[model samples]
Target: MAKFFGNLNAVLVGGLAVLIVIMFGLHSAVLGESIYPNQLFRYLHVLCGIMWIGLLYYLNFVQVPTMPSMPDELKPAISGHIAPRVLFWFRWAAAFTVLTGLIVAHLSGYLVEALTFQPGVVLIGIGMWMALIMAFNVWFIIWPAQKKILGIVEASADEKAAAAPRALIASRTNTLLSIPMLYCMVTQNALGV
Candidate 1:
């Protein structure tokens, strides 16, 4: 038990197993019957979106602002050790969030309507577009710039300097877009749009 709890992979699997058990108990023999494929996609979309936005917030609200204040020597610890792993999860989460969201929309029979913003799907469409833009920033703008800024790719001092602000701005743009994106997503479902 101690060994299982100590490992992150094990802990995650154990937690999920517990959740399945609880769900099974609650639903009894009808456990899988009430769960729809779209619901699964929705669950996955929300999970990935949380990871994506949570990391975006951590980068914007915590890491970026705090970096300038850290002593020069200590800065390397975050840049070298923490940022890389966080970025891996961040970018993948963004990708998966978009993928799962699209799957949900398609499964629910609104992919075209949502993308086209057909009268009833305008709000969800807006949220989807924002998410797409945010995902694009994560992959194309932020990740590329971050590679140089973090020295993952060889770069001159001037290049690294240039990359930092690009990454910062793109990240900040996503943060700004996230607010309206979240509102649209939540309200569309809540208000029955």
Candidate 2:
């Protein structure tokens, strides 16, 4: 159990297997049909969104604040190793979240309406647009800056200095957008809109 739990791939596969079993059982009993594409895409969207936003919150609430007090010698462990890995998951999760969300909207027959902010889908449209902006920040703004800041790309001292604030601003912007974005997403269903 310890070995299985300690291996991330194993744990993820095990969890997915469990989910599949549960889904099949429930769907067979209740719906008497296969899982819908929209439902699958919605689940993927939620899963990826959680990873993206959870990492964003971790960076803002934990790493950023804790970094200042960390000793200089200890900093490399974060910047050189931990940070790069976090950003890897962070950017990809952001990309997948957006992709899955778009697929969900498309499969649900709201792609055009939501993108155009049609009357009935205004809340979800707002959430979708905000998520798009946040994903853009993750890929275009934050990732580039982070490459420089973390020395993944060669950067001059001044370049690294500039990247820090750029990344920080974009990250914080995403964090800010996530609150309303999440609210819109969650409330849209509750409000029956």
Backbone clashes in model 2, listed as residue pairs:
none
- Residue ranges of candidate 1 with Cα displaced over 4 Å: 1-4, 27-35
Cα lDDT of all candidates, in order?
0.92, 0.92
Off by over 4 Å in 2: 29-35
- As a TM-score, model 1 comes out at 0.93
Tens-digit per-residue lDDT, 1-193, candidate 2: 8999899999989999999898887765644334476787888999999999999999999999999999999999999999999999999999999999999888778889988988878899999999999999999999999999999999999999999999999999999999999999989777746
| Candidate 1: count of backbone clashes, pairs at least 3 residues apart or interchain | 0
Q: Estimate each model's TM-score.
A: 0.93, 0.94
